[model samples]
Structures are given as C-alpha cells and as structure tokens.
Target chain A: EPEVTQTPSHQVTQMGQEVILRCVPISNHLYFYWYRQILGQKVEFLVSFYNNEISEKSEIFDDQFSVERPDGSNFTLKIRSTKLEDSAMYFCASSQTTEAFFGQGTRLTVV
Target chain B: AQSVTQLDSHVSVSEGTPVLLRCNYSSSYSPSLFWYVQHPNKGLQLLLKYTSAATLVKGINGFEAEFKKSETSFHLTKPSAHMSDAAEYFCVVINSGGSNYKLTFGKGTLLTVNP
Candidate 1:
C-alpha cells in the first residue's frame, strides 16, 4: 500500500530559529493536512490544504506558521521563530476524498 | 462541536482473548467514525471506519466496529487478541455532513496484550 512519507524523523532547533518540516503525500491525494501532538496530549489539527491553498486553520496556527505545496509531490510546514511550545510530533496526512492517510510524523524539538 | 470519548485509558488482555475498546461520540449531524491504531514509533493506521453505509463495519486484522446511532457509540472489537495487537487506539470523529474537514480524536486507549 502506498503511504505518506515525511523527512527528517527528528529535528532539533534553537528557539527563535526557523524550521521547515517536509512531507510527500500519496501521489493521487487531493487534500492535505497537518496535525500536531504534544507529548501525552491528544492530536490537534493545525491546518488543511487543498488546491494550493489553505482551506482551514486552527487558532494554534498563528502568524508564525505557514504551509506550502511547492511542487506536485512535496508539502511543507514552516515555522518562523520557533518557540519552546513548538516541541511536538507533527504529522502530515493526505486523502483523495473522505479518509486520510497519515505519515510516520516528524518530531520537532525546540530548545 | 464534535468530539469523541474513549471510555478506557488502558486495557490488559491475555493472548487469544477477546478484546473490546469502548468509544462514545458527540456530533450534531451524521458523523464519520473511525478507529486508528498506533504502534510504537509508527504512524496512526486506520483500523476501520463507519461512513453510514453499514452499521457493522469490518476492517483489516480481524477488527470490526459497530455504529449505534441511538447510543451515540462506535465501539471496536476483536474476537481474539494477539501480542502484536498491543498499541494505542484512538477513536476519531469527522463531521462529513458539515463543511469542516477537521477530525476530532479521543484521548486514546492503550492496550497491552500478555502472553
């Protein structure tokens, strides 16, 4: 089965630095999403992307966060001025229609 | 406005025993319910989903879920458990009839299968 893939399973970045998490969703998927989970917390939705634009975003996705589908296969989430609270597991997901498939996730650590 | 509640935080079962993980949901409209399994260091894998087509939904790994609209419950079950089935289980609810694409996840249930 084809699955979504994320790069750099783990990343460590300094506070106030910029970090970008990359993902390659399933080839035929039409919708993309980003979710995050703080250690011991429930998964929280960050944003959803479709047709090269963001469909919806949560309050947690403030001015510092941005998402881009720079290419047909690559979808990325960039955070400017990373904060200590940014430390969490970020997941990328894609779906052709109803059900979404998730990637292994990228663990972001800010210090 | 949509949420899921997993009744159990942890469950311990011996190998070859039946397993049940309870879940209750709150949605204004007809909800699209799903059960996902997360193994250590792995992504969330979809176990089964109820899209209103059938009340009893069967999925991979001999897992199944029944959507009881009257009860507002969608519970996951397996007739026999295996050591490999130990993992964190999440009950997810999506408002398919609504315009929002967000998915509400439960706190999660950790299942430990013993020998």
Candidate 2:
C-alpha cells in the first residue's frame, strides 16, 4: 500500500538554529497534516494543509512554525528558531478520504 | 469537541489468551472513530476505523473493534493474542461533518503479550 514518507529519520540541531522537516505525502492525497509527540506524551496536532494553504492550526503551532507545499509531492515544516522544548517526534500524515496515514516520523533533538 | 479515553494504561496477557483494550468516547455529533497501533519507535498504523458503517469492524492481524453508540465506546478485541501484538494502542475520534478533521487521541494503552 502507498504510504506517507518523511526524510531525515532523525535530526540533531543546536538550539536557536532553524530546522526544516520534509515529507512526501501519498501522490493522490489532498489533505496533509503535521503532529508531534513529546517523549511520554500524547500526540498533538500542529497544523493541517490543503490546497496549498493552512486549513487549521492548534495553539501549539505558533509563530516559529510554518508549512509549505513547495512542490507537487513535497511538504515541509520549517521552524525559525528551535528550542529545547521543540525536541520531539514529528509525524507527517496524509489523507485522501477519511482514513489518514502517517509517516515513520522524524525524531528532532535540540541541544 | 470530541475526545477519546483509553480505560487501561497497560494490559498484559499470554500469547494464547484473548485480548481486550477498552476505549470510551464523547462527541456532540456522529463521530468517526479509529484504533491505531504503534510499535516501539515506529509510526502510527491504522488498526481499524468506524465511520458509522458496521458497528463491528474487523481490522488487520486479527484485531477488531465494536462501536457502541449508546455506551459511547469503541473497544478493540482479539480472540488470541500473539507475542507480536505487543505495542501501544491509541483510540482516536473526529467529528464526521466538521470542516476541521483534527483527531483527538487518547493517551494510549501499552499492550504486552507474553509467551
């Protein structure tokens, strides 16, 4: 079955640096989303993208976060200034219909 | 707003025994419910989903869930647990008609199946 794919399975970055996480959603999917899970915490929604625009975002998605569909297949999340609290497992998901599929996730570590 | 509650934080069962993971949900409207499994260090995998179709939904790897609207529950079950069934299970709910499809996930339940 086709699945969402993300690049850089794990990343280590210095605090205050910028980081961009990339995802290639299923080719036919129209809706894309980003979620994050702090270690030992529940997964929380970040933002949702559709038609090259943000549909909705949670409070957790603040000024430092931005998402882009730069190409037909690539969706990216950029954090302007990373912080220690930003370290978490970031998941990219896509849905053509109701059932959504998630990528393996990119583990971001800030020091 | 919709929410899901996983009753058990952890469950342990023998390989050959039946397995049950309890879940309860609250929704103001008809909801779409789902069960997802995550092996350690892996991404979320959809086990099954209830979209107001058949209440008894059968999913991959012998796992199934029954949606009980009156009880506001969607509990996952497996007749015979396998050692490979050990993983973290999350119950998710979403408003069916809402424009925002943000899913509310339960904290999750860790299932451990022993030999």
Candidate 3:
C-alpha cells in the first residue's frame, strides 16, 4: 500500500538554528497535517494544510512554525528559531477524507 | 470538542487469550471513531473506524471494534492474542461536523502479550 514518507529520520540541531522537516504525502491525498509527540506524551496536532494554505493550527504552532507545499509532492514544516521544548517526534499525515495515514515520523532533537 | 479516553495504561495477556482494549469518547455530535496501533519505531496504523455506517466494524488482523452511541464507547477486541499484537494502541475521535478534521487521540494503552 502507498504510505506517507518523511526525510531525515533523525535530526540534531542547535537551539537557535532554523530547521525544516520534509514529508511526501500519498500522491493522491488532498489534505496534509503535522503532529508532534513529546516523549511520554500524547500526540498533539500542529497544523493542517490544504490547497496550498493552512486550514487550522494549534497554539503550539506559533510564529516560529510555517508549512509549505513547495512542490506537488513535498510538504515542508519550517521552524524559524528552534527551542528546546520543540524537540519531539514530528509526524506527517495525509488523508483522502477523514481517515488519515501517518508517516514513520522524524525525531527532532535540539540542544 | 471531542476527546477519547483509554481506560488502561497497560494490559498484559498470554498468547492465545482474548484481548480487549477499552475506549470511551465524548462528542456533542455524531463522531467518527478509530483505533490505531503503533509498533516500536513505526508510524501509526489504522486498525478500524466507525463512521456511523455500522456499529460492529471489522478490521485487519482479526481486530474489531464496536461503536456504542449510548455508551459513548468504541472498544477494540480480538478473539485470540498473538505475540505480534504487542504495541501501543490509541483511540481517536473526530467530529465530522467541525470545520477541520483534526483528530483527538487518547494518551495510549500499551499491550504486552507473553508466550
């Protein structure tokens, strides 16, 4: 079955540096989303993208966060200035409708 | 607002035994419920979903979930447990009438199957 794919399975970056996490959702999917899970915490929604625009975002998705569909296949999440609390497993998910499929996730570590 | 509650943090059962993972949800409208499994180092996999079509929904790997609107529950069950069934299970809820289809996930319940 076709699945969502993400790049840079693990990343380590400085606290103040900018980082971008990339995802290639299923080819035919129209809606894309980003979610994060702190270690030992429930997965939290970050943002949802559709038609090259953000549909909704949570408080965690503040000024530092932005999402882009730069190409037909790539969805990227950019963090302008990373904070220590931003370290978590970031997941990219896509769906044709309400049932979303998730990628393996990118583990972001800030120091 | 919609939320899901997984009753157990951890459940242990021997192989070949019946397995039950309890879940309860709160929704103001008709809800879309789902059960997802996450194996170690892997992404979340959808087990089954209830979209108000049927109350008893069957999914892959001999897994099934019952949607009880009166009880506000969608509990996952399997007749026989396997060693491969060990993983973290999450119950998710989504409000179809909402503007966005953001899912609210439960904290998760860890299941361990022994030989």
Candidate 4:
C-alpha cells in the first residue's frame, strides 16, 4: 500500500533557529494536514492544505508557523523561530477521500 | 463542536484473549469515526473507520468497530489479542462532515497484550 513519507525522522534545532519539516503525500491524495503531539499527550491538529492553499488551521498554528505545498508532491511545514515548547512529534497526513493516512512522523527537538 | 473520548486510559489482556477498547463521540453533523493504532515510536496506523455506511466496520489485523449512533460510541474489538496488538489506540472524529477535514482526537488508550 502507498504511504505518506516524511523526511528527517529526527531533528535537533536551536530555539531561535528556523526549521522546516518535509512530507511527500500519497500521489493521488487531494488533501494534506499537519498534526503534532507533545510526549504522552493527545494528537493536536495544526493545519490543513488543499489546492495549494491552507483550508484551515488550529489555534496552535500561529504566526510563526506556515505550510506550503511548494510542488505537486512535497508539502512542507516551516517554523520561523522555534521555541523550546516547539519540541514534539510532527505528523504529516494525506487523504484521497474522507479518511486521512499518516506518515511515520518527524521528531523535532529544540534546545 | 466535534470530539472523541476514549473511556479507558489503559487496558491489559493476555494473548489469545478478547480485547475491547471503548470510545464515545459527539458531532453536530453525521459523524465519521475512526480508530488508529500507534506502536511505540511509530506513526499512527488506521485500524478501522465508520462512515455511516455500516454499523460494524472490520479492518486489518482482525480488528473491528461498531458504530452505535444511539449510544454515540464506536468501540474497537478483537476476537483474540496477539502480542503484536500492544499499542496506543486513538479514537478520532472528523469535524463538520469533512468540511475542513480536521480531526479531533481522543486522549487515547494504551493496550498491553501479555503472554
């Protein structure tokens, strides 16, 4: 079965630095999303992308966070200035229909 | 608002025994409920989904969930648990009939299957 793939399984970044997490969604998927989970917490929605634009975003998705579908296949989530609280497991997901499929996730560590 | 609740925070079952993970949901629109599993350090995998088509939805690895509208529940069940079934289970709901497709996730239930 086809799967959503994320790059840089783990990343360590300085608190003030910028970080970009990349994802390659399933080829035929129409919608994409970003979610995060603090260790031992429930998964939280970040943003949703469709048709090269952001469809909606959660309150957790603030000014510092942005998502872009730079090309047809690659979707990226960028954090302008990382904070210590930004450390979490970031997941990328894609959906051809109503059900979304998730990637393995990118572990972001800010120090 | 849309929300999901996983009633049990943790459950323990022996291998070859039946397993049950409970979930409840609230949705203004027709609900789309799903169960996802996460092995330690791994990504979330879809166990099953309920889209209002069938009350009982069967999924991979012998897992199934029943969508009970009256009870507002979608509980996952396995006839026999395997050691590999040990994982974290999340119940999720898609808000507003997929208008934005943002998923509201439950707190999750940790299943421990012992030998």
Instruction: Tell me the deviation in Å of residue B60 in model 2.
Output: 0.3
Q: What global local distance difference test value does model 2 have?
A: 0.93
- Model 1 segments more than 4 A misplaced: B97-100
Clashing pairs in 2: none
lDDT of 1 by residue, A1-111 (tens): 899999889999999999999999999988899999898888999999988898888999999999999989999999999999999999999987779899999999999
Q: What are the TM-scores, per candidate, against the unseen true structure?
A: 0.96, 0.97, 0.97, 0.97
Candidate 3 residues lying further than 4 Å off, grouped into runs, are: B97-99
Q: What is the RMSD of candidate 4?
A: 1.1
Task: Tell me how candidate 1 scores on lDDT.
Answer: 0.93
- Residues B1-115, candidate 1: write the lDDT tens digits: 7899999999999999999999999988888999999999889999999888989999999999999999999999999999999999999997443333667799999999999
How would the candidate models be sorted by DockQ, starting from the highest? 4, 3, 2, 1
Query: What is the lDDT, from 0 to 100, of the residue B58 in candidate 1?
Result: 99
- Clashing pairs for model 1 are none
Model 3 TM-score, all chains together: 0.97
Chain B TM-scores across candidates: 0.95, 0.95, 0.96, 0.95
Off by over 4 Å in 4: B97-99
Q: Which scores higher on TM-score, 1 or 3?
A: 3
Q: lDDT values of the candidates? A: 0.93, 0.93, 0.93, 0.93
Assess each model's interface with DockQ, reporting 2 decimals per model.
Answer: 0.65, 0.72, 0.73, 0.79
- For candidate 3, the docking band is medium
